[model samples]
Target: MLRAQDLMTENVIAVTKDTEVRELALILTENKISGVPVIDGTGKLIGVVTESDLIFQNKKVHIPTAVAILDAFFFLESPEKMEQEMKKMSGVTVGDIYAPEVISVQKDTPLDELATLMAEKNIHTLPVLDKEELVGVIGKSDIIRTIAEGR
Candidate 1:
């Protein structure tokens, strides 16, 4: 059966938390990739930053609704949500917007399981690991390319 190791890209383009937003955008555009894995000084995967995260910078912040009743204001929505949005909108570096929770696959993971995980999670890029070591990377394009080549 086809596995992650069969189709994954061995040479991966990645970023660090200290990477600036402008540089991240340029990397994405120049490399023609939608996202990249964020690694630390030790080369350990810590997060995933995507185009969606960068796009979020332009998203309008939604103010929480408050209902004024009897001279008392009661917020109908959580104000924390608005605070989070504001923080995301003001992000200047990958560390400010990258998703810390990452989903990874093993080298031996079957294609069906890999596809299912990506589909279910709505993930465009995934890190492939072997015993907690990054081995390769697999993106949606890889799967589509495989189908096109009838692999």
Candidate 2:
């Protein structure tokens, strides 16, 4: 019957939108954590940035297939997807590439619900919130640690 507050790691490491990608990478490497929460100037939780965002920079762009008929051209795939990929590929800062949708849990959230949300969404770092304020974070590693330690 554990709740998020039971095991969530306090003293969260967070970054602002303007933080450079290189600095963010260094932070993750030095801390040995996969990701961190992104906060705004007001310290409001705005998003979560992870290692995947960094990796996205190196992924090969899959150009959408297109065909031409009459006097117009048709794209077999979504051009918007390609545009998004290109943007991420050239991102210089956390603001350019961070996942803006904040998938967070409150301190009192049940552990089971938190686990389920993470599994379903494939989230690695989940920010723990108290109202609109950033408080702590939970990660997949935390869940694994809890299980392995038989807590």
In candidate 1, what residue range of length 10 has the lowest lDDT sum? 79-88
Model 2: weakest 10-residue lDDT segment is 127-136
Off by over 4 Å in 1: none
Model 2, range 29-71, lDDT digits (tens) per residue? 9999999999999999999999999999999889899999998
Deviation in Å, model 2, residue 122 alpha carbon: 0.4
User: Model-by-model lDDT, in order?
Assistant: 0.93, 0.93
The clash tally of candidate 2 reads 0
Clash count of each predicted structure: 0, 0
Across residues 62-129, which tens digit of lDDT does each residue of candidate 1 receive? 88889999999999998888787888789999999999999999999999998999999999989999
lDDT for position 86 in model 2: 93
